[model samples]
Target: MSHTKLIRMTVDRTVEAEPGVGPDIEAWRRSVAGVLAKSRRVSPDELGERPEDLLAIRTEDGVTIRPLYTSADDVPEQPLPGQFPFTRGGDPLRDVNRGWSVMARFGVNERDPEAVNESILAALESGTSALWLAVGGDNLPVEAIDRALKGVLLDLAPLTLDAGDQAGAAANAVLALLDARAREGDGVTDRSRVSIGLGAAPLTTLFANNYSPLGDTAKLRSVDLPGAVRLAATAVNREETIRALMVDATVFHDAGSSDAQEIGAACAAGVEYVEAMLEAGLSIDHALGQIEFRFAATDDQFQSTAKFRAARQVWARVADVLGARDAGAAPQHAVTSSAMMTQRDPWVNMLRTTVAAFGAGVGGADTVTVLPFDAALPAGALGVADSFSQRIARNTQLLLIEESNLGRVLDPAGGSWYVEKLTSDLAHAAWAVLQSIDGAGGFSATVESGWLCGKIEEVRAHRETEISRRKIKLTGVNEFPDSAEKPLPVGPDGTVPDRLAAGRVFRYAEPFEKLRNRSDLHLADNGSRPTVFLAPLGPLAEHNIRTTFIANLLGSGGIEAVNPGAVESSGLADAARQSGTRVAVICGTDKRYAQEAPDAVRALREAGMTSVMLAGPQSAYPDENTDVSPDAYLGAGIDAVAALAELLDTLGVR
Candidate 1:
């Protein structure tokens, strides 16, 4: 439960004479003025900086938060814990006695049963609270499954299939195998602690370059799919014990999202799923009960923890709105992000995952899964290094659980100013966005209108700008790029096992909602280009960057550089001719621009342009080596005015 107090700023405390017992308002004013004269007045400078006019920042969800919050921010009508709404927490103290579990996944090689057994044994020895076994294929090799179950107790969370893969066949195949095996052992299939990885399949289908089940039969129809995902979920209910379900955040970062966007998107997705299932005949309790989330565990601990707390408030509000009879009022699961992990300095991922895992635990996540650091680089090439990364992540969680015992406290970050403020802001923002979605007639409607993707794109654009400008420091990638570091090795013979492909496709969609928000690739730099065309190639909202940047450049150069609407192939020739523009500089990011640069350059050349300048780099150029013959480029931190000046000199703009 939150214990912070907010104070209200008001003049109500100032003394005033009562009408019945004292003088009139005029007399009171006169008296106050006389008292004020006794105090010394200060010069203009002494007044210090005046506060900016208070403005409310509204989140995409529609939750409004003021610039400042005080004691008056509390809702007196809001119920306390252990009561309706459960806004403070599921319990008054947030169920602090029981800490959340640390879940670890053991990779099973279908051909090597012994290796699978050893991996699970190592995970258990390393103090992982639950066993997360990522099955190799559709048919769970009985031997591999036995290895995972060898010494693991029935109460422990079992190996489960990930749903991030859109192929229903993979999800169904794992479910069928788990069901078959469970029936052979316990006879009551419901007594197994396992997850079928049903969440986020839809979103996963959108990003996968390969096969996707969400596509129409026009694509591939050979796969037999599950009618409802929860049927797989219900198959291993585990009686009274809460079973783990996967809620992944990988796609969110990969999709090019911000930390706040990650939390907001995940919360929205979860709400949609819960509401949808409930409407389709499942009880609210059962719907939330059988679910869990898997978020990208990045290096940003505060934002990650805030994501967890924000998720709880979102769920709590929904529960209050529903007023369900037997619904447990807790946020289900929190998965860490893998987007920030780098293949360059693979060892650093351990520290990154540790921080992310801590945030999840403190933020009230039911379980935390830290993806291995080297996992970002391929699977087997750096096999030993990847194993170390995984072990380090596990050890970090164990050390926290046993030594620091941070998990022992509920809302450990409750009263702190920073955490409280972050929580309040996150909740209010996410809530508002949820309300907006509701007003728009729910998830499917918003998706149809492209409203959901639009919001994500907006946030993604801002983050991209920050990252490009180096406002956000990714240690090895940008901030402290290693000059002497060797490139991460790829798989031997560059051959990757097909099983990994299945696993990659099987990630939950909710986590990817934010993690996948990353731009497809990094942008190169623009050295000096007079006419820079900022074409936001991919699925991003255009911000009139061409005009703004060119205007600023022209202003510095004592010339008028024009931006001709949005630069496109059809109009490039006309716009350039009409505006008397010469060079066209492309200024989009990797995700969108990298794939579109070649065509844009070709079209520009055919339109009679002599030279093309890339505002970013050749990395974003469509054809790697086939030069559109870009003459110059500019990266983050380059002086915009300087770059433009150089370009003007080249173009004889004076």
Candidate 2:
């Protein structure tokens, strides 16, 4: 059958289609309601007015994702790609066959300039189209720029720099190199073909450094802000394609800001830079052209896609307000989030980065950078990504673009009801956040006054709470943990580097990783992980559900759960003793719990069990069985981190 006919047949099978008539959406909804009612064992009337919300999900950004969407859903009229506001895309005639620029990030270790050069050459020779070089402070020395770019073709591959506090020196070195390449007439016939990003982000620097020198005008001016702007003006005068500044919202994202907050903060920072450049004697168009916006692409695919679209819409509004409506489409670069990478089971990061890259591509990012999976590991002094990891990172983009053909359509997510509505909602929400920031004396002022950090902290606290309750699952760290997995190689001292930068880094799995670290130390000292005795009160059919539940929960904290078959209350004490652990958990069905839990708890306690937990909720016990209480309940929605920490302490694991 033809592909079109097969798709039509599939849709026909999904909906209730009358013979010789079209498929009916109302019939489809009725069928769905019937299925839900039968599965839930309730009358169809009991299903609330909005049955879609039954499967709806609420995001951390306060956006609700409904179960289904149709044309009836309310959303603003969307224009074609490359239209005004540029929400669909920045270019109407984008080459569908040519995908986004695959950018590779290399942290230039001053101690190993040769290694950095080798990696850069390999990346460019492979599939990478651009280079994001971290230079200056704690990276490659500014003077070593020449050696780093020794064999690179400056005109072909784009170059971006990350130089904190040394933007002037770094820009000069790069510009000088480009000049020499042009003077030598070696492959650089046109300077406009060469793209360079100076990466001078003053607002990001202030946030990372805790708003240092705030309220001191002289000290603030003494920073590299003026020099960065002047360098950008020089690039414009020389007719070179160099974006001298960046509005990097990844700083806010790593600090745990929500999606709306990241977009709003980025827009505010862009406005701040525009005003500064205008004050430095540059036109609005030149200022906008000299700046690019960077955002974090996360594992949440739909949200990440919507975030980029919403960011473009909101930024266009900002530019229009500044009297630059014709040049409102902001250049965007998306990088996989560093905060989402986990040290334990770091291999899963590959899946996360793939999804993030897909979202960034569909969201119309100009460039995407996938950080290596092992970038968070402490293998070397600087944790440099191995060549294998870098190869995988670049190949991920290649597969998505070449094999999957993900870049063959412009605004692939456009015209979908759900994506359109989400884009509009996110745009409005982010605009509100930007308005608040502007009202509070703008981005820099908010950061200096601690307003931005305070708001981000509130969201972080809530997110952490959800993570502790397992509402937000970290696949390897907090869910399906492998206590027996071999540890990844570490540094010479076998220590993970302290990545805390002014308390701005907030890794979602850090709390659970800390508990695991303690467990590792105990195992190193005692030759066994902390053990928990799981007492099943009945046959496998009666207790297997809770048995698996409690076992996985305990394993998340690096604690082993030992099940010695089904033990009667009389044998509970002996089984506990055989396990050689002071902590125990009772696992059984509700009916079994009401019949035998009290005796089981009594037996374990009399045999000197220090702490006994039940694998169900406290309300599962009958009202009259007040004696059926375990010390703690290990069920859903409980704070797993706190409970595991307490169990480790009680068992002398620390």
Candidate 3:
């Protein structure tokens, strides 16, 4: 064959359609055009008017959730379960026989060993397949593992430790228990079930110093990493199938990290550990096997699902590069996020926990730990799983596995085009950040440099801004808050580890709590909450929505809104004075505002109202176009915190 002929043959193959094909994408595109034409597409006068614009919500992780997904969108190759990438799952069929382990946290009060023993025995007997004991802290003696687990069978329930800084000491105590139990002839039949989270992410000890000057001990603290890895080797050396170390992505997540940041930091930490383990003389498989990845499952259902799937994808890729394809299947343990928990309406936390648990299950977590409804409450406010709270937490899994039968299908969210696309997007985004962290000399090094701390603070500011604006609503605190609710009583207190980490575990609802506290202090001093008067200018229906909106807005900041009933424009000033509030918001429709708001706002301003706000947009009654204008606007788009602060200042509440 001539050279020209060979080139022609190769070029012809590119354009040739040799056989029958599936449905035509061009035909679908034409159909979509027809549908849009027939449906009479509306004009996008506003940004959100367009379907794509309205639905394309960008997450902090830098992933944009599109309105619709299709086959045309680039989808990652769907590897079978337990395969490379491990996006579908690592233990392919594990959930079918034994669904995710019900690992409930059982905090021990060693001062009262009898109560602690009874609690542990009761917890194991009642649905809990594993125990995550608080090993450090004054409540749980660092060396009293055997005493706490006296009645509990070591062979049955898998035991994990959260020993804080004393993690190495705690693991030694547990190993001692295992040795003593072996002498008693009750040994682990399948060591695969045994896991001790000797995961001392020493970086957590240096984590975030709350945007302050870096301390001298901060970078120096993670020196414990080598000791943690060496301690982890003991289990691997014994031929035990226990996870010795952990990648605590939740620490980053709870510290206000975006989903991608959390996973990226985790992968970075895992890679750092892998390198350290290789240098420490452990084989790649042994090193990978000795570690597990832990992530927080938040109430954002699909986000959490994408999070777990993406985490595994990133870890699998990391492991694959390290020449351990089998070990790439990252074992995951998910717990409901503490950052999503609340303090005021503690009961609502159950719903949040349930949703998080469901997401964790759907996300294919190997072990799911649902926090108690009262988990956010102080130890004095809650004991080792109050009966009601513990039952609810455990039953969250029961409802999903037994009742909902969620475990029947392997990788239930596997082929979903949305989930798959989301998982791919999340994986790539997280991996990019992970690569950046690697470039900066790994996880511990990032902490030492305060790069991770700075990154976290940026996200924290964004989240706080959203919360303060009420753009992200907290059901009880910022919306339908219970003003009359009493504070939940705390349980007996215990000493928390003086963790070297100088960071706050931020929640979106935390700012609201501060606002609520200010309100409490105001009430105590003045015998009433800082109040806003509703100066309605029209009928009930016209003014009710805006009035209620303003009320909720001011109330979100712990200020009360007083409505002296809907009234005409002429009576607004009298009603404002009768309501006895300095902040008066004109509430009415645009049409009514053009008719009556001018007089109402004018009257309230002349009637000694210091801060006169309009419930609706200020553009509705522009001073250039009308007789009066509000001093400030109190509406959907305005920053709630700033508005409330100005209002409180006007009211002389603080």
User: Which candidate ranks first by lDDT, i.e. highest?
Assistant: 2
Residue-wise lDDT of candidate 3 within 337-397, one digit each (tens)? 8788877676898888888988888888888999877766655354444677778888888
TM-score of model 2 vs. true structure: 0.91
Q: What does the lDDT come to for candidate 2?
A: 0.82
Instruction: List all candidate RMSDs to the true structure.
Output: 14.9, 4.1, 9.4
Best by TM-score: 2
Off by over 4 Å in 2: 1-44, 74-77, 211-223, 380-385, 487-495, 498-503
* Backbone clash total, candidate 3: 5
lDDT of 2 by residue, 1-654 (tens): 999999999998888666788546667767777888999999877886655567788777788888888768857667777777888888787668877889987764554677788878988888898889888666888888888877988677788988877778888899888878778887767789788998888877677555321122212111367777887788777646889888889878888889999999889888888888999899999888888889999998988999999999998898899899768886789999878888777789899999999999999898999988876665442345467777999999999998999989878898779988888889988999999999999988998899987887788789999999999999889998887866443334333554323245577887787777777777777988889999998898999999998888887888889999876667889989989988889899999888888888888888788888889999876667676578998999999999999999898976
- Give the range of the ten consecutive residues with the poorest summed lDDT in model 2: 213-222
- In candidate 1 the C-alpha lDDT for residue 239 amounts to 39
Candidate 3: regions farther than 4 A off = 1-54, 73-77, 95-97, 108-111, 187-193, 208-223, 379-385, 487-503, 625-628
Q: Looking at candidate 3, what is the lDDT of residue 239?
A: 43
Q: Best to worst by TM-score, what's the order?
A: 2, 3, 1
lDDT of the candidates, in the order given: 0.51, 0.82, 0.74
Cα error, candidate 1, residue 31 (Å): 32
Would you estimate the TM-scores of all the predictions? Answer: 0.58, 0.91, 0.86
